[model samples]
Target: MNDSEKISILSKLISFKSVNGHEKAIAEYLQELLNKYGIESEIVPVSDDRADLVAEIGSGTPVLAVSGHMDVVDVELANWKTDPFTMTEIDGKLYGRGSTDMKSGLAALVIALIELKQSNTPINGTIRLLATAGEEVGQAGAELLQKKGYMENVDTLLIGEPSGYRAVYANKGELDITIKSKGKAAHSSMPALGNNAVQHLINVLNKIQASIKGYMDIKNDVLGGTVFNIDVINGGTQPNAIPGSAEAVLNIRTIPEFDNKKIIDLIQSEIDQYNNSTNGNISMEIGMEIIAIIGNVNSKIIDLIKTIAQPYMSKIKYTPEQIKVAEKQSELTGMPFSTTEIKTMGVSGGTDASKFLIDQPNNANYVVFGPGENNAHQDNEYVTKEMYFDFIEIYKKIFVEFFK
Candidate 1:
C-alpha cells in the first residue's frame, strides 16, 4: 500500500473516539475492513459498549497473533492545535489521540494484512490479528479474551504497543496500595481532646518509605529498578475540627524479582512497627492490590523475537542478562513480585501483552511492538508518517516470515 493510502486509513481510524472501554464503533469498523479482505473476523464483545475484534487469515499450528489495543486514553480537545480525535498532518507528523500510542500500529497491521492477502502468501501457520479494547482501563478486554479461551491455541503473541521499532519482551508489573488510618475526632479548640488520624497516617507513611529503601534498588538492567509514588491521598472533610480519617494511595511499579505479596508484607510490617512505636490512640488499615504485568523473560520467546528482529537488532545499554539477574535477586530477597517468563526490551510501560502472555494457555512467544511516544499519556500525542509506514513494513515482514 502507498503512503497516501496508509495516511487515509489512519485518518479515518483517528476520527473515531474509541476511548478505552468505549471501543465498539472502531471494533466494528475494523471488522468490516477485515471482512472486505476476506479475512474471517469476529467481534468478541466484552460488554455492551466494549468489544475486541479477532481476525484470522490462515489456520494451522504455531499461530502468530498480531495484536493492538482498540482504545485511546482520554484526551482534552482544548489543548490540541487540531481536534484530538481528528487526524492532522502537519509537516511530517500525524497528530491524533491514538496516532502514535497505537492507532498507527493498528493501521500498519491492517495494511500488512491487506498486502499479505494480495500477494497470495503461502504459510504453514495461522496469522491472527487481535484488536482488543479497554487496555487503558484495566486490560479488561484482554482479560475477557483470555477468559473466553482465545489465547489457548496461539503459539506466539505480539502486542502493538509503541516500542520505537524495538522488540519489548518484558514489562514491569504494578501494585496499587491504599493505606488508611483512623482516629477519634473532637473540637480543635482542645488540643488534647481528641486524636488526629492524619498525623498518624503521615507517620506510618514516612516509616514505610524509610523501611522500603532496600526494595527500591536499581539493580535490574532491563527493568532498571522498583519505583513507588503516592499518587493520590484523601481523608479530611474540613479544616476546623481534628480529622478522624486519612489515607494515601500508592502506585508501585515492581521489577520481576520482587513478589507483590512480599512487598505488601513489608508495608504491613512497617505499619505495625509504626503503630507499636507510637503510644497515640490511632488505628491503621492497609489494603494492597497487585497488578502483575509482563516481566521476566521466557527463553523460547526471546529466541523467537530475536530471530524476527535479527536484521534490526543493535547493541543497547540494558541486556536481558541484567534483567534476569534483577528478577532472580528480587525473588531470592523475598519481596512481593510477579515475573513474566518472556522478556521484552525497550519497554517502560504496561500493555495487554502482559495478560495475553501470562494468562494464555500455551507458553506463547510474545513481544510488544508499535509506534508512539515514551510518555504516551502526556499531551500533544503525535506520530510521524515515516514511523507509521516503517511499522507497516515491519509488520509485513514479520507476518510473512512467521507464517512461512
Candidate 2:
C-alpha cells in the first residue's frame, strides 16, 4: 500500500471522534474497513458505546498482537490549530486528536495488515489486530479482554502508543488512591466548637508526602523511581461553614517492586502515627483502588524490537520539514533527536502494555512503539507524515519477519 492510501485510512479513523467511552462507532467502522479487504473482525462490546475490534490474519500458537486503542482523549476544540476530529495534513504533519496519541499508529497497523493479506505472505503464526477502547481512561477494554480469556494464548504484544521512534520497554505502574478525612461540623462563628475537615485533609496529605519522600521511597533501574501527585482535593460546603468531610485523590506511579499492599501499608502506618500523635477529631479512610499494574524491562519483545529498529537507526534521514519540527521540539525539551532514528527508552506513565504483561508470565513480551511525539493529552497534537509512513513500513517488516 502506498502512503496516500495509508493517510486516507488514518484520516477516516480520525474523523470518528471516538473519544474515551465512545468507541463503538469507530469499532464498527474498522470492522467495515476490514470487511472490504475480506478480513473478518469481532467487535467485543465493552459498553453501550465502547467496544474492541479483534481480527486475525493467520493461524497458530505464537501470536503477535498489534494493539492500539480506538479511543482518544477529549479535545479542547478552541485550543487546537485545526479541527481536532478532522485529520488535517499541513506542512508534512497530520494534525488531529488521536493522530499522534494513537490513531496514526492504528492506521499504520491496519494498512500493514491489509497489505500483508494482499501479498499472501506465508506465516507460521497469527497476527492479531486488537483495537481496544478506554485506554485514555484506564485500559478497561484490555482488562476486559484478559478477563474473557482473549489473550490466553498470545505470545507477544505490541502497543502502538505514540513514542516517536523509540521502543518503550518499561512503564511504571500506577495506583490511584483516594483518602477521605472525617470531622464534626459546627458553626463557623465559633472556631473552637467546629472541627474543620479540610485542615485534617491537609495534615494527612502533608504526612503522606513526607512518607513518600522518605521511608516509602523505592527505585528501579529501568523505570526510575516511584512518585505520587495529589491531583484532586475536595472538601467543604461553603466558605463560611465548617467542613465535615474532605477527600484527596492521589496518583502514584510505582516501580515493579512496589506492590499495592506495600504502598497501602506505608500509608496506613503514616495514618496510624498521625492519629496517635494528634488528639483531634480527625480520621482518614482509603477509597477504591483504581489502577494497579506492573511492566517488564527484559522481555523477548524488547529484543525483537531492537533487531528490527537497529537497522533503521543510523540509516534513515529526515526531511527538512521533519528536521525543523524535531528541532523545535528538541529545543523545547532540551533533548536533541536530530540524529536519532530509533532508540530504546522507558516511560514514566502507564499503558495497556501493563495489562497484557502483568499476570501472563509465559506470554508477557510487551513493547510500546509508534510514530508520533509524546503529545497525547496536549494541544495541537500531530504526527509527522514521513515517520507515520515509516512506522507502517517497519510494522510490515516486523510482521513478515516474526510471522515467517
Candidate 3:
C-alpha cells in the first residue's frame, strides 16, 4: 500500500470507538480488512463486546508476531480540537484519539504484512498480526491470548506502542493497590465525636510518600526507580458526617530490581508501621499486579531490531516548534530527543509486551517500537504523517532482514 492508502486505513481504524471495554467493532473491521488481502484470521473472544484478532502469514519454527492493542483510553470529547473519532490532518500531523496512542501503528503493521504477502516473497518463518482488546484497561486480551496458548510458538514479539522512533527494551512494572482506612461516623455538629477516616487516610498517604522517597534512592539506569501515584480516593457519605470508611487507589511502577510482590511487601511494611502507631484500623490490598520486564539485550531479535533501525535513527529529527509541542512527551518518556539520540529508553508505563514476556520468558523476545510521538493517553494526540509512512518501510525492512 502507498502512503495515502496507509493513512486511509488508519483513518478508518480511528473511526471506531473501541474504548477500553468496547473493542468488537474495531476488531471486526480489522478482520474484514485482512480478509480483503485473503488473510485468514481468528477472532478470539475476550468478553461480550471485546475480542482479539490474530492473523498469520507464512509458517515455520521461529514465528514472529507483530502486535498492537485495539482498545484506546476513553476520550473526553469536550476537550478535543477535532472529533476524537475523526482522523484529521493539519501541518503534516494527523490528529485523532488513537492516531498516536496506537491506531497508526496498528494500520502500519497490517499494511506492512499485506504488502509482504503481495510481494510473493518466500519467507522462511511466520509473521503474525495480533490485535488485542482491553489494553487500555489491564491487557486482558493479551493475558487471555497467553492463557489460550496463542503465544506458544512465537519466537519474537514486536509491540506497536507509541515510542517516538525509539525501540524500547525495558519498562517499569505496575501494581494497583487499594488501601482502606476505617473509623467511626458521627454528626457534623458533634465535636470530636467520631474518628475522621478521611484524615486517617491522608495520614497514611503522607507516610507512604515519605517512605517512597527513601525507596527512590534505589534506581536503575534503564528502568529507573519505583514510582507511586494515588489515582483515586473516596470517603465520607455526607459533608455533615465523619466517614466510617475511606479508600485510596495507588499505582506503583517499579523496576526489575523489585517485583510486584516485593513492592507490595514494601507498602505493607509502611502500612504495618502506621497501623501499629494508630488504633490499627488501616489496611491495604493488591488490586492489580503486572510484572516489570527487562529484555535480553543479547537476544538475536534485539540486535536485529537495532540494526534495522540504525539507518533510520538519523532520519528522526524534530522541528523547533515540533520539539516545543512535544515537551511534555519528552519529559514523560525521559527521551530528550531534541539533543539525544533516539535509542532504547524505559517506557514510563506498562504495555501488552509484558504479558507476552511474562509467560515465555526464555524463548520469546519482546520489543516495543513504533512511529508515533509520545501523545499516548494525552489530549490532542497525533502521529506525524512522515513517521507513519516511514514505519511501513521500517517494519517491511525488519521482515526482509529477519527472513533473509
Candidate achieving the largest lDDT: 3
TM-scores of all predicted structures: 0.80, 0.87, 0.91
Ranking by TM-score: 3, 2, 1
lDDT of 2 at 398: 85
Pairs with backbone N, CA or C atoms under 3 Å apart (clashes), candidate 2: none
Query: Which one is best on TM-score?
Result: 3
Give the lowest summed-lDDT range of ten residues in model 2: 286-295
User: Residue-wise lDDT of candidate 2 within 336-381, one digit each (tens)?
Assistant: 3636545555566677866665575222467788777757779999
The residue pairs found clashing in candidate 3 are none
Badly placed stretches (over 4 Å) of model 3 are 237-239, 310-313, 321-333, 336-341, 360-364
lDDT of each: 0.72, 0.77, 0.81
What candidate 2 gets wrong by more than 4 Å, as runs, is: 184-187, 272-304, 310-338, 361-363
Ranking by lDDT: 3, 2, 1
Question: Mind giving the per-residue lDDT tens digits that candidate 1 earns over 1-404?
Answer: 67787788899888988876678888888878777777778998888898899887767887877888878888876777888888888998888888887888888888888888878887677888888888876677877787788888877777777766455666666666778887778788874777888888888888778767777764456666777788887766777888877888877766656756677888878777777887444343443332444433663444555565444333223357755775575476332222322224533467776667665422346677776644476567888776687668767777776654
lDDT of 2: 0.77
42-77 per-residue lDDT for model 3 (tens digits): 999998999899999988867888899988888888
